[model samples]
Target: MQETHDINIIAWWGALLSTFLALVKLWELWNDRFRIDIGYNFTGAPDIGNEIFVRNLSSKPIILSYWELLYGSGKWPFRKLEEIESPGPDACDIRIDPHSSKTFTFAEENYFDWGLKTLKGRKIYMRLYVAGRRPVVKKLYG
Candidate 1:
């Protein structure tokens, strides 16, 4: 009877430890899922032709400092980064609430500096810089 009791106690401890470990793993997985979704849409407007969307998937608000456009001119093995200059309300001031999204539009005139007629029909990508986190990158066009 004493041996059976000892075995039961050990089994109880084992089950408790397993539960604790599983809880820790669940917490890690929840934290790992903290991220944002960034994408773009071409509006085809004559003046402002592009709209970029940012969605915060985490429970906290996400502040975006700025975003860059990545593109390759030729067969070169490298791409270039062009910082987009938002017209008003500096990009850094943009905040996205948890489970919410925001859109940014750029005027057509901005493309002149990139030597492109328009942002459409070109190989382009976006990289959004977030405070206290790694920059989020996504393919925009091409």
Candidate 2:
């Protein structure tokens, strides 16, 4: 009778652990379901600077707080500017609705002001982030 009780207790513990693990996995899935998706477009290279457009293709709203531009060669990377360095506003907080888009006008003059040389024939990279979200980076070679 004691052996049967011990087996029952062990089985109960095992079932409880399994249930807890399943709950944790479900929570992770729920969090991921709400995360936003960003889509990048290399519009064109007009002479001033590269034109790039960013859009939120996810089904949820995203709050864009900050973004950075990186220009470099080989393996060495350098940061060009942030939203603070640009014109639109000092605070980079912009809310994007689902399937909506926003255009950012980045000029070569801004890069020169940041002490970076002309982006002609150079590889330019971009890294943008939404508030309380991960950073998305993209590279464009012209």
Q: Quick one: best TM-score, which candidate?
A: 1
Q: lDDT, candidate 2, residue 46?
A: 38
For model 1, the superposed segments whose C-alpha errors exceed 4 Å read 2-6, 9-17, 20-28, 73-77, 82-91, 108-122
Residue 112 CA displacement from its true place in model 1, Å? 8.2
Candidate 1 has its poorest 10 consecutive residues by lDDT at 111-120
List the candidates' TM-scores in order: 0.64, 0.49
Error of 1 at 80 (Å): 3.4
> Against the true structure, what is every candidate's RMSD?
4.5, 6.5
Error of 2 at 102 (Å): 0.6
**Model 1 — TM-score against the truth?**
0.64
lDDT of 1 by residue, 3-54 (tens): 9999999999999999999999999889757688777666556385667787
